[model samples]
Target: MVDADQTFVIVGGGLAGAKAAETLRAEGFNGRVILIGDEREHPYERPPLSKGYLLGKEERDSVFVHEAAWYAQHDVELHRGQTVTAIDRGARTVRLGDGTLIAYDKLLLATGAEPRRLDIPGTDLAGVHHLRRLAHSERLRHELKQLGRDNGHLVIAGAGWIGLEVASAARGYGAEVTIVEADPTPLHRVLGPELGQLFADLHTDHGVRFHFGARLTEIVGQDGMVLAVRTDDGEEHPAHAVLIAIGAAPRTALAENSGLALVDRADGGGVAVDESLRTSDPDIYAAGDIAAVHHPLFHTRLRVEHWANALNGGPAAARAMLGQRVSYDRVPYFFTDQYDLGMEYSGWAPPGSYDQVVVRGDTGKREFIAFWLKEGRVLAGMNVNVWDVTEPIQNLIRARTAVDTEALADPSVPLESLT
Candidate 1:
């Protein structure tokens, strides 16, 4: 239980930080609750940046985690647009960018992840965009609208979720788009070749050109404005705008500077935390994208960058901080939307860990429930264009039950029956 006089400080203003602040209040931590963020805006969700928000279907107000007045009403101090520069573990305080020190009885670091930047020439040119924050997406959205009706070509580097989603949006805006990826198949590292191929085919059907197994050597530009992207094979693809969406890296500088244990960079660098979300210092906890937590089910330490983990991990960390019996054991989950296809996936299995995939429904028709299994036990499940079955799919993975392959691939056999 938290003492009445203790102050709880939450660093980072992203989803995880905001959720942790809410959890602390909900759990009756009445002491000073300060939520600090480097950005001017309050906590907001990021999924819509590449989808509805970019397309102007969603308003700016909808992205915020809470209204401006909510914080004042809840007695939570809102410190925005200020950076937390250092952590003094012995003093139990953090120094802000402006050199103001704030004491804390407990600290939660949810610094989140930042987009990995491209180091190629012409990257600093105008019209070259990277979508991680609302500002980036807003700029890209405006440029896409200005380049209306196939008037300009948009060249995108990397074929990950952000790249593919941006491709879908660009196509919707009637812009000619081309994607450059070093991998032969996009998303192959995460979804495996077969399923990854499905996404490649999906984009191909919608008239999006792909340069597979090709590396981007330079961004060709004129007068500080992007004109095209040049690949290693000497192929120059024309473009008026460019987006770099390779991936993201965790913001672990605060953890590293404070001498906190961090996971190896090769294995996804982030602050290391146990199943309880506690760092080397028990009073400090790391959650969300900044936490490399041990997953009990997979028997491995994994860092997840999805919204689900941030949403659930916050409360779990708060409860654990309060000395409650808790464990952050929720299965890893994520989803993506492209064109007319939507998918929801549960469970986390590294590539080559699963022996086989048993798929139900029809892949050709773009509707299916694919289950990845190892030693006849379900490890992960994904439902594509299939509704009302996510719970059952997740249940199948959580139970870790040995399943009949035939029944798993049969449309008539309910997934719940397997568990």
Candidate 2:
């Protein structure tokens, strides 16, 4: 049942692609493995780019998934600084930008996502930045340091995770930070008004200014350098540097060109995949940010763009490719570290999905576990400064059983006992 001649080609050299290759070897797949990526650096994790690395708490080497020699020793043919221009599904081959064609028996797409660009005028001006890649982080670190030394002002558009994290880092460097968000509260779409205000308060207490209910209209520049930013509210803030942290869009050009099915943009655009992470084309699979997987547990197609998904989804896809029975039902999880407040969120409860939010512990002290419950059933949970409760929290979501509201909000009630 095994063939050494079979070759598996993986497009994208991020954490998902790298882990898939590692899983293939660990699962005893003797077939040839070829990995292709456009970036010059070896495959690395993206979290550090915005977290430890940007904050100068982590070295450049710590971001990489494996040492440079690991791929060579593992017999994984890595193509760095190379792009897969097109996929010829009929011929089962992929064409590289250099015009090289490589055949494959099975193909995996882990192309990840790119930062959304600001469409306003003066985007090309110097000091206007977007943080999505390692190069961008490195450049932003230098800019933040310079801004800190001169007490320059940083104008950030969009109060999403990236925007808030960058603001925290800037504040750590003693730089002036002002965030302009169109939404009424920070992380409005994700956490809703109840908890979103918590984040807004946290930043305000740290000397960061917030311009809510406003959208950046244009980046005013002088001599091809950013001077200030004008918001839709007709307010112009002097800024030495500007950051656009709107969000990220999945890289689905290759999948689209190859005729792979894609999820609608409104429903969170991505490569449509089944529970096993298999694409419409039987020979092709998708994982990570690009895979909008039909989750058996949630009973809906969900595309999660988080570090945990890539860390686990890649190996799951790899096992599925090896003809192993697989079902990807991992609960959506993500965490954030901003200033002294660190938090972890498990499960999905997008606005309107939950009826009530119950909190345990002390919100005033910034140590609490907030649960989103629908009809007394836990849909999601977020622990701020609370540790060792992830398993119990995820278990509650998986159980899908109604819980007593008073008991749920009581700190003396152990989560494990409730589960």
Candidate 3:
């Protein structure tokens, strides 16, 4: 139960913030809760915007997380187009962009991630875009709409989830998309070789071009608009536009300015938070991609950009915000639907962490699953078309169940048979 006067202020109204607000109300908190989002429109689902929303299958209104009426009825103070300038934890006040201060007892930072940009010359050209926000999606939708040709060239930088999804959307939008990845295979880190190859084939079957081992030297534009991309191999392509979907780093400026401790990395600097999702400051908590949480499953601190993590982790932060002690130990599940292939993956397979991998399905039909096991225990698994097996395998991984190497290689034996 929440005290009537206690005000909970959540900064950044994305999936994490919106879900936190709704989850708080569902958890029986009737206190004054204010949700501040910089977006002009109400909170919307981002996953579809990269897939169905861009393909004209889903409408903007159909993808909204919640309507204004729903939020009003639940007693949430929804502030759109509002920016949080600074956080004064000592005073328990947050400064807005319009020079107003809002006081709160508990504060949640869902500051999300920003798109990784390319520093090439013609990157700022007209046709170069990054799929980060809803506005960006709308712009891309309009651009794809304008192209009268069925196979317009759209060059992408990375083959990560966003990059591939955008490629799929663009392909569905009647544009011929080409992915330029520095890595050998798509999703090399997460999906490993076998599963990533399946994804590559899936995209290739849809008439997508893969430029593996391609390094972009310059974004060559013509007449004030993107025209071509020059690679390190001294080759220029007839490109209509460039979509830089490399990846994203956590939005940690707020945490850094507040003198909150951060999970330092040699590569990416992410927010450092304790087990309760509380930041260095006890009164404040962090969630979503921004929060670098210590995971019990991986035995390490991690920052996940997965939709499931945002939907689940934000509510866990809300619970901790309400002074309820509960450990958030949900094993992360990630999924992506590209063309006819559906992919689902769970658990952590750090870079080169798995020595030997086991495959249980055939890659010929592209309808199989593979698992990454370390020392006879399952660490991670990826399903290409057979996603129904993720549940039983996820449980086996969760339970830390060990299996015989031959049994793992056997497809006839159900994954649950080992139990």
What overall lDDT goes with each candidate model?
0.90, 0.95, 0.84
Maximum-TM-score candidate: 2
Best by lDDT: 2
Candidate RMSDs in Å, in order, are: 1.0, 0.7, 1.6
- The sequence of per-residue lDDT tens digits that candidate 2 reaches over residues 1-419 is 34788999999999999999999999999989999999999999999888999999999999999999999999999999999999999999999999999999999999999999888998999999999899999999999999999999999999999999999999998899999999999999999999999999999999999999998999999999899999998999999999999999999999999999999999999999999999999999999999999999889999999999999999999999889999999999999999999999999999999999999999999999999999999999999999999999999999999998889899999998887
The TM-scores of all predictions, comma-separated, are 0.98, 0.99, 0.96
Off by over 4 Å in 2: none
Residues 1-419, candidate 1: write the lDDT tens digits.
57879898999898888888888889988899899999998888898899889877899899888898989999999899999999999999999999999999989999999999888899999999999898888999999987765578999899989999999988888888899999888887888887889999999999899999998889988989998889999999998999998999999999999999999999988999999999999999999998999877777898999989888988788777778877788889998989999999888766899999899999999999888899988888889999998889888888876899999999999888989
> Candidate 1 at 116: error in angstroms?
0.4
lDDT of 2 at 44: 97
Best-to-worst order by lDDT is 2, 1, 3
- Quote the lDDT for 40 in model 2: 99
In candidate 2, residue 300 scores what lDDT? 92
